[model samples]
Target: MNKQAQAVVMLLFGGAIVRASLTDMYLRYVKESLRPFLIAAGLVLIAAAVMTLVHEVLRPKERAEEHDHGHDHGDGKPHREPWVAWLLILPVLGLLLVAPPALGSYAAGQSGTALSSQQISDYPPLPPGDPAKISVLDYASRAVFDKGVSLGDRTVRLTGFIASGPNGEPILARIILSCCAADGRPIKLGMSGNAPAGLANDSWVEVIGRYTDRTITDPVNEETIPYIEVETWTQIDPPKQQYE
Candidate 1:
């Protein structure tokens, strides 16, 4: 590609990235903490593209001279690396034409939780709240590895989607994202009783339950997953924040 074409493509890609971040479309792939970084990256890319365009426009004769020099001394063979530049179009098109959806139940079921030794330390006390709203990772750590010592008879509520499980069973599942959807892992909690009848896959539900069993084993890792004795549940609209 020529310098002008390259600069235009860069500008389009940079604008697309900025637009996605501004519109919250970036949340579909990454955590909210990355918003500022993404915006900055997009702006930097845009600035680089604008500078390249300006330099190319103002010094067209110099660019032409350099191009001639590059070929004139050589065998007049074209550079093979320019074709690789086309690969950029794939992500650009993906963002512009068909923005991908967030990883859902299918991906959750496919992945398993792996707790690093560093992450298995003593958890602090739960924050103040009725029922003490807790995260799936916290519940899993306390219930599985800590043997439920921290969760003493406290009524806790968890919010996640229904994942695929054995027939007549309800599995409460959450996706734990480190950086983005590509690095997300699934943390699952099994329910003792059946879910509300006919609850579809990816159905967002708020489960009001307490830790039931500490011996629950994860099907994926053969380690432990959180088990909750269902006190009650209610179907709700998908939350604005989808990942933990």
Candidate 2:
């Protein structure tokens, strides 16, 4: 490519690096899986820029004798080695060696659906004890569509972080998000039985519970809302991302 075209490519590559480094969204969604490839692409772009610079600097002058022999200026550029392009491989290799983790606690305070409460009356009740275990997302989504009537007295297990409610009580909560943690809304479930066992905020837990659809007035907001009443709760390790 010509100097101008090479320069534009270099600019784009630099812009991508800046963008990836500045925003967590791209790292959360786009760069996680393709980290190695992105690193490789960055290195390649850097190499291209260096090679273009070298070629521009070392370009040889045309010979007068060659012109007499019917030789052309050949686009006024020297033949460049494609192997020099491999210099781009360095960044990618580094990324491949050290892929970063996904978005984490740093985004806990962001505003998003991951932390929002859902309408409890919308979900079907849990069916009587069955072997097929369901996920918290299924329960939450169902709660959004229909009240937990279909879950009737069935024991459902939910796993998530132990976030504090408006009150001093330890609530088993999980952040449900529309996109990344930035949009996460907190959903708190009321644990029944004995008070949560040695539970602490941000700790992970698996709670087996019967879904009770009842509205409890929020002391902070003074608004009555629905919540899942827990039957059993067990503490466990916190997952990488509290919200998926």
* TM-score top scorer: 1
Cα lDDT of all candidates, in order?
Answer: 0.77, 0.53
How many residue pairs in model 2 have overlapping backbones?
38
| Model 2 misplaced stretches (Cα beyond 4 Å) | 1-132, 195-197, 217-225
- Candidate 2 lDDT over 169-195, as tens digits, reads 666555555654345555545455554
Give Cα distance to truth, residue 149, candidate 1, Å.
2.3
1-244 per-residue lDDT for model 1 (tens digits): 6676688888888898899999868888899999999999999989999999898878858656654444443767544335677787777777878887677788866766554334665877777876889987788788876667788778788898988753336688888888998898888877765344468878999877777773455566665566887788999988877899
Candidate 1 lDDT score relative to the true structure? 0.77
Model 2 lDDT vs. the true structure? 0.53
RMSD per candidate (Å) reads 3.0, 10.4
Highest lDDT among the candidates is held by which one? 1
Model 2 Cα RMSD, 1 decimal: 10.4
lDDT of model 1 at position 69:
43
